[model samples]
Target: MRLALAQLSIESAAVDDNVERAVSAIETAAEEGADCVALPEIFNVGYFAFESYERAAEPLGGETHRRIREAAIEHDVSVLAGTIVEDLAASADAGEAVPAESGLANTAVLFDADGKRRLVYRKHHLFGYDSAEAELLVPGDQLPTADLGGHTVGVTTCYDLRFPELYRRLVDDGATMVLVPSAWPYPRVEHWKLLPRARAVEDLLYVGAVNGSATFEDASLVGRSTVYDPWGTPLASSDDDATVVYADCDPDRVDEVREEFPALRDRR
Candidate 1:
């Protein structure tokens, strides 16, 4: 399948503009023959927009998700709607299973080409270092994977990349590819690049690290969105530009890499 990592320019608290940009990216990816397109973290609301988290929070099937779902159906491509600030109470009222009854959560949803809600992954790790993310949003608890376009896909967010054990769990659950929607910033460019590459190497799966491109009041995003193969080889990458990084990935590559290396079999 062809995967496109959308490196979007996220404006702080600019929900409408950002969502519009995301939709445009999806359309462009479909035009480029991408089977699936993944956006960066909090594409609607900038990740550094802490004060606007509450105001921008929406339910699972809120306007932002509805728009993304519709785009997927219209474009005939699957979409990973990056991450959004979710209103847990509203989601619960809408009959969606939420991690909490109230408060907010950083959530990512996957929509199939037919506009089916394939997977919902809330961020398991909430970043608190020099940010109000931990204080403002609730962390996700479930680690789920879904099958899409002949690949077993897993979802993770920015901070979740630091946790290798989580990736191992997904591998155990039969994941062949993992999409990491991130809003990584400057000064930590090495960390952002290294972690996802390491995850792909360790799990022997496709790792698509999607990041945003924008400068906020407190931080500036490092837009090195990349797609790594099972061999830790970068298939496609961008350099801090708002563009779509595309890579053709085959699920069988994961098995082939594992069989050739025979490293995962040695795991204790």
Candidate 2:
């Protein structure tokens, strides 16, 4: 499978413009023969735009998702719609299960080439250090996985990478590839790069770490969107720029790595 990571140029509170960029990236990735394209976290409202969260929050089937679903069908390529600020009450009103009936959540959705909603993963770990995420959003309660392009795919958000147990759970759930939609900031570029590489090495699966590119009032994103193979090799990566990183991944590679290493089989 060919994977594309859309390291978008995010602007704070610029919903329409950001969404437009995401759709364009999807089209470009499809044209380049990418089977799946993943966007960065909060690509619409920007992760550091805390004040705009309430105004930008929408239901599961909101306009952003509608546009993404349409794009997935038009391009005939699967898409990970990155993370968005979700209104839990509105989602419940729309008959979608949410972690809470009230308040907002940092959520990510996945769509197949046929425009089907395959997975919805709210961020399980909300950042609390010098941020408002923990106080503003509800943490996800479930880990969901779906099959896409001959790979069992899983979804996680930025801070979730710090927790290796989460990726282990996905591995137990039969996931071969995990897409992480992140809005990681500057000053911690080493952590941003190291965590995903470690996750891929330990889990024996493909790890696609997608990050945004923009500077906000308080912080700036460290782009470097990358795809790490099961053997912890960087297949493709980028600097802090607005671009799409592409890599070809084989689902069979995961099995081969695991069988040759036999590390997972010896887990206690």
Candidates' C-alpha lDDT: 0.95, 0.96
- lDDT (C-alpha) at residue 213 in model 2: 97
Question: Native-vs-model 1 lDDT?
Answer: 0.95
How many clashes in each candidate? 0, 0
Q: What is the C-alpha RMSD of each candidate to the true structure, in Å?
A: 0.6, 0.5
Query: What TM-score does each of the candidates earn?
Result: 0.99, 0.99
Residues 1-268 of candidate 2 have per-residue lDDT tens digits of 9999999999999999999999999999999999999999999999999999999999998999999999999999999999899999999998999888899999999999999999999999999998999999999999999999999999999999999999999999999999999999989999999999999999999999999999999999999999999998999999999999999999999999999999999999
Residues 1-268 of candidate 1 have per-residue lDDT tens digits of 9999999989999999999999999999999999999999999999998899999899999999999999999999999999999999999998999888999999999999999999999998999999899898888899989998778999999999999999999999999999999999999999988999999999999999999999999899999999999999999999998999999999888888889998878998
Model 2 pairs whose backbones collide? none
Q: What is the lDDT of residue 8 in candidate 2?
A: 98
